[model samples]
Target: MPAFLESERLVLRPVTASDLDDLVALDADPEVMRYLNGGRPTTRESVRRRVLPRLLHEYPCLGTPGFWAAEPRGGGTFLGWFELRPLDDDSPAEVELGYRLNRASWNRGYATEGARALLRKAFTELGVERVTANTMAVNARSRRVLEKAGLLFVRSFTEEWPDRIDGSEHGDVEYALSRGEWLRRHGG
Candidate 1:
């Protein structure tokens, strides 16, 4: 397994072909998918054929950067996954940071902890100029995670959705933090 990073309470590692079941289970939870896919569950086959292959392929072409499965440090139980995908336009030092955790891990600061670690890696190791995250405008929980990680709200904008949820009309919010901003927040 290619380990990308480690935080105080979590381990961030690359996704392997064997991680399909864990990924499927995480995506199967309705609450986890509420804002992402209108609470629609993803099929195992879709993950096997589409998602896993794409993630694996991305690592090589993108300089070993892609999705990392988050596991508890001591026991290494799969909690969820974090993504640090490079922009398709090939912009250097510009990547999106995102996470999805099991419902069991909600409100426990796992997301914030993992995100902060990833942000640090992006700015310091990957030479990332900026890091961005986005979630449903009504997802206060996710927004709080972004804020706790030192990312500020950049905008709230509406986009067409194939499967609209009750709050889809409220649009989505984008949060961002530059490398300089992160440094200032850390007083380094």
Candidate 2:
């Protein structure tokens, strides 16, 4: 079956070949890429040749896994993307959550909405034991989203960035929540 999940205001569908244009446009926005690649826009060639292939190859063999192209419900606008998958191929029980939204969608609770929905699914139906998210130390926006999604502050660590962006000097922070924690938070 095709991969998909729906929230009240978002429909997260698998990233497919046809989503190439939307992916490119999302990456082209410097505002959206500010935290990811230092505001550098991804070339269309890269999307066509590399990125799309990687996303297409990752459509979970079973459940709706990997990255999803998130759009507003009952619409065609590409708000952004969200991911809820393992840190690596071998770590099935430990998942990581992440999102990248267009500037237009910012401050509208779309990010938190998608994240909460993903977390609920992970703990309830996806066999996920732990969920983690990391972002630049100075990224208050993303930090807030993670917190609102019920992930607690885990730790801060420094890592070398190949292309070290403007805020890379401050290191990164990780936030996480386990299945037990989720259950307790939701009174399950």
- Scored by lDDT, the top model is 2
Query: Looking at model 2, how many pairs of residues clash?
Result: 0
Clashes of each: 0, 0
Question: How do the residues 1-188 of candidate 2 rate in per-residue lDDT, one tens digit apiece?
Answer: 24378999999888878888888998899988998889999999998998777666552422455788888887878888898877666655888899988889999999999999999988888788999999999999999999999999999999988898988899999999999999998998
Top-TM-score structure, candidate number: 1
lDDT of 1: 0.85
lDDT of 1 by residue, 53-130 (tens): 866755433477567888988777889889888765355467788999999888889999999998988888777788
TM-score of each: 0.94, 0.93
Q: Candidate 1 — which residues are off by over 4 angstroms?
A: 59-62
